[model samples]
Target chain A: MSKSSFVAEAVKKYGQDRESLMPILQYVYEKKHYLSKEDMQEVAEALDLSSADVYGTASFYSFLDTKEKGEKIIRVCKSISCDLKNKEQIISAIESKLNIKNGQTTPDKKFTLLETNCLGWCHKGPAMLINDNVYTELTPEKAVAAIEENL
Target chain B: MSTDKLQKFKKRIDLIFSDVNWKEILDKALKTSADDIIKELIASCIRGRGGAGFPTGLKWKFAAQQKSDKKYVICNADEGEPGTFKDREILDKQAKKVFLGMAICAHTVGSDEGYIYLRGEYKFLVPQLEKELEEFHKELKAKKLDFKISIRLGSGAYVCGEETALIESMEGRRGEPRNKPPFPVVSGYLGKPTVVNNVETFVYTAMILKDGSKQFCELGTKDSRGSKVFSVSGDTPNPGIYELELGMTLDEFVELFGDGDTKAVQVGGASGFCVPRRKFKETIIGFEGIPTGGSMMLFNSSRSMYNVLHNFLDFFCEESCGQCTPCRVGCQQLLKGIVAVKAKEKPSKYLEDLKGMTETMKSSSKCGLGQSVPNCFNSIIDNFKEEVIY
Candidate 1:
């Protein structure tokens, strides 16, 4: 199915109730990487919610994206446990390797680097989640090598 | 001590990966009356393991008394607390026990439908958790049980861990918490009487039903019964899950998980108290002292106290729902105050002013996120004043 049709189908599957907004956004985000303005508008119309209502809920969450994102999103845990284990060095390594600072996407739009709260990998500190795969107990060298191999 | 020292500690209520007959417990719960189940829960003295140590039986009794056609039981799987990972382990391994716990809760509360508000980051665990749920449903069908459970994903919002905010998220709106006169027990999840319990709480309830409430009541201190599963991490050699009796002293815990150079321990995740080395011997890990939601992060001499406080403050600043002014402004002020002190831009007295601000946030903030956000900040700064200020 096409992207628009897929979103329409997801909206139908989740239902047109106001409570279906989150799931609809989630389904769209999964299918199309980030939530576009047009998609949000479509969802608002389908769920009988205003665009602002849909956008407000979407923006309140850190996972939902209002703008276009790269193919891969790298989230580094900057919580206390990871911080105690040199999270800074690991973040710096990713920046230098990707040639982009935190919260910035690469020039080619292949990767986006962002810092997040605990990813529940405290035992394995200095953890980073690239897309859906979690790499824990990371050193600077290992982080750089992992990103490079994927790149 | 080597990582092997972790084994020397006693394991109690956390039976995540253990093989057990959940069907036996379900059969027993099915045979028992709802009031009897609540009475047994009260006898067991099992409180909600979701950081707030509210009595589990009392919550059920209140919800059961309410007259409603549609009641609900919610499993708070949104384990987003920094330095906490025990719920994730439970969901990953022994998900059926969690489901059984929910079923027991539903049967006790007279609710046939349940929902697990899973955290968004654990989206990867969805396929596996759903598979487990499918099998569980098949078993329920075989046993002629009418209860059913569905999973709802939280969208990367920490505030959703709060019961009201979690309900709002379930309603598909912004995950902001509501005011409290009518708590979730009276009106929740589309304004129905709902009971929300943590993943560990549910598993423990199932265990209690299986082994008998008297067996559970006999385990811990008189006030705080049963064992707790702690997610031990940070500067420790063995950074993993440990299930222990609730009343164990911090000194004993430090001997087991702490490295030789341990300086402090952040008990109960970021929202919990930070215990300095001097107070480790006096502190207890149960309701009589500091109650935890299963996050025990240790700090060694090598770790900077200032950086730790900074990270926690930053997390609160970003995660706050911004609906309440106290939390919204208080978190920002605390974060800025700490930075100013570290840079000598403000006098050390600035911290004293921040302490007063934290008191306001503690009393006035809308939910637990804002209320307990100052815990680590105040404890770390007060305990390590020299390192934090100069």
Candidate 2:
């Protein structure tokens, strides 16, 4: 669904109460990959809120992106638990394979490289999250393979 | 039931419902005017219960002081400490209170957005919170309120419970602590001014705002005024959440649940101090205990202090966020020293090295995860030298 339609549906479901905008934005972003200005405006009107409120909500949450959408997302676990397990090596391995630095989306927009906090599986360590699914006990080869599989 | 057992159960149940007037809680949180809401919080003096004990009102004032067009509030529901479960209780029994507190905080901080970043194993709370949040949003919309909140779940890393790490995880990045020249108060979440508070800190705010600061202050100690919820697990008769005044002694707390079999009460969680039985008198519930605003697990003669320290070290070794070298590597070195000592590989000979590493971790680590990494071990060893030597 388009971002506008998603916002329209959200406004229909959760009309312009300023507080409902966060969840609405989260739902729309998850669905359309990014929240557009139109989506933000539609959300503002529905909640009887200003465009600023809608934009603030979107920018406040890391999960809700207002920028141009990426094709693929990469989240590495670089917290202590994962670090102890050699997450750095895995990060470099992915960087080498994709020929892109962390936080940069690939030229083709096929990938967005990012590091995630903990992601909760520290026992397994050296973990990475692709979109929502988590990949654990990752080595350089595993990191490359995981990226390739997603590609 | 014996009078003692009956009283124990009564105390436990009372904590969940005790003195907390639900109607007042709802009324105070549902204020139509932002000034009334901020006034209520200012009157509460509810400080952050997550160990720091900074006044909640002041924290809002700091973030609200900034003239940035965008601001944010984060509820640090990530209770990943080994023995802490109070966050789960507040989120479970008082999810509305948690949500309302977040709204009040946002309104007070001049932010239109809020997030409750909970640890992952709290899967049980997700659906419960989702339903509660759905209802809250409905009611809020019906009133045309402008702020909104959401629950973000964390997987399992204990360090993720730290504010910066929590922010990193929320941003879909690795849970490492950012340097503090720009604390979360200045730049957080999506690089916005954010205020992260514990579940108890927020819940208490709902009450304190409803009642007045003088009323909340009428309860605990002078410096630490308020009732604190303690888990009181390990070697206790009734191992559960207990609410007590800030000045309550550790012995008094132990007597409430420990049938006199208590050897030591691990005041605070694994990251807190290990007050030995002798120094029990020194342990008070509030700031003195370094509550971590978490549960209190007790240990008796059956558990060795040495073993407890060993296990806690293992947990830290495994839970560091890996960005800083001291904590990521120091934790492992401390654990290896413990193992070698256990294997009779060395005696107190390695104690100095471990102590040196512990000091380095306490002083140099980037985040709370690194700084607090050696707290439990240091407390145990410093207070109970004989235990480790043996």
Candidate 3:
């Protein structure tokens, strides 16, 4: 099915209510990996909200990506607990293995590494979330091995 | 001391996944009058476990008295507080009790629909939580209960942890906090009366119903009653969840969780205060001293006080919703000012000016995010002046 049709179907499931905007965006992101301008326009038409409104709401959240993104997103927790556990070592390992900075994606568009505030895994620090799966209690070596294995 | 001694010093509520008869409590709560339930909650003196410490009974009373046909019971499962993982554990193990508490609240407040605003980062737990909800729905159906609940996922915003901002996120807008006086109890969730309580608060509500309110009230201090689940992490040999009596001193807590080299403790999360080792003996963990929303992070002597304050300020800067001026600019200014001072580009006297700016941010900012952002900054600068300046 077309991406527009898929998003339109998702919007229809929640009806034309404005309150369904966040869920609809979430659905589109889940299906497409990132929200595009076209997706926002489609959602705007379906929900009777302006494109700017849809885009603004989408941009406000850290998870919803409007621009092009990789297939797998690796979010490193940069908050205090993870920081205390030397989260920088993990980030450095990923950078060395993937050859990209914290906010950069691989040249092949396979992976995107980003920094995020607390992933709620403070007890098991030095944590990172690759896509939806959480990998915690990470050492630099474990983080690199996990990324390489995924690749 | 060994870890066993530390374990013995703590109190465990055991309400979550305690094999309690939850269905019986739900049935009893359903049959009980709303007024009587509110009275029981009042008698228990249980407050909102979501860090605000607002009286849970008064919140229910306000929502129940709103005279609206449409009301809502929201379980604020958006556990975004850094170093606080107790809610995640509760929701994982005792989701049934959490839902039961919501149903009880809905029955009292005359609402039939509910929502759990689960955080975005914990989206991985959604399938498991939904499965639990499905089982709960079947049980509710068998009992012929009218209340139903649906899950809504947050999209990676920490400001949504605030009640008003959470309502906005549920409505599919930017997660910006709304103004008060028309609080959630009066105007919430599409301007209808809504009761939003923390995950732990609702679980405790169900537990209170299962055990009499008097028994629960007998546990803690006069001001802060009952047991609290704390998320302890950092510089501890065993870092995880612990349920303890509400009014334990920091000295006792340090003995249990703190390492020998522990220098300071962050009572709450990013928005909480920091207590140095010297003050730990006098500090209490309840409302009378420093009220926390279940975060107890220990920093050892090796950890720099300057870096700790810097990390928290950076978090506030990124998480602020930018709806209000003071919080938006104040956070950035504090972050920049601290960096400049540390770099020695700005004089140490400049910190006093920044401290005054924090006072303005606290008084004039839009929401709790702005108002409380200065807590760690003020506490750290005041307590560790030498470390911060030199």
- Name the top lDDT candidate: 3
Q: Can you write out model 3's per-residue Cα lDDT over B320-377, one digit (the tens) per residue?
A: 9999999999999999998888889999999999999999999999888899988999
Error of 3 at B249 (Å): 0.7
Instruction: Select the stronger candidate by DockQ from 1 and 2.
Output: 1
**Candidate 2 chain B: worst-modelled 10 consecutive residues by lDDT:** B9-18
lDDT for each candidate structure: 0.89, 0.71, 0.91
Write down the C-alpha DockQ for each prediction: 0.81, 0.04, 0.91
Model 2 misplaced regions, further than 4 Å? A1-151, B1-44
Q: Each candidate's fnat, in order?
A: 0.81, 0.00, 0.93
For residues A70-109, what per-residue lDDT tens digits would candidate 2 score against the true structure? 6667788654435545778998999999899998888888
lDDT tens readout by residue for model 3, A1-151: 2457768878877777988998889988987779998899889988889999999899999999998889899999999999999999999999989999999989999999999999999999999999888999999989988898788
Identify the leading candidate in terms of DockQ.
Answer: 3
Q: Can you write out model 1's per-residue Cα lDDT over A1-151, one digit (the tens) per residue?
A: 1248756988879998877778888988877778988888888888888999989999999988898888788899998888888889999998998899999999899999999888998998889888777888999999988898788
- Residue B344, model 3: lDDT of 95
Deviation from native of the Cα of residue B146 in model 2, angstroms:
0.9
Error of model 2, residue A9, in angstroms:
18
Residue B333's lDDT within candidate 2 is 87
TM-score of chain A, predicted model 1, versus the true chain A, to 2 decimals? 0.91
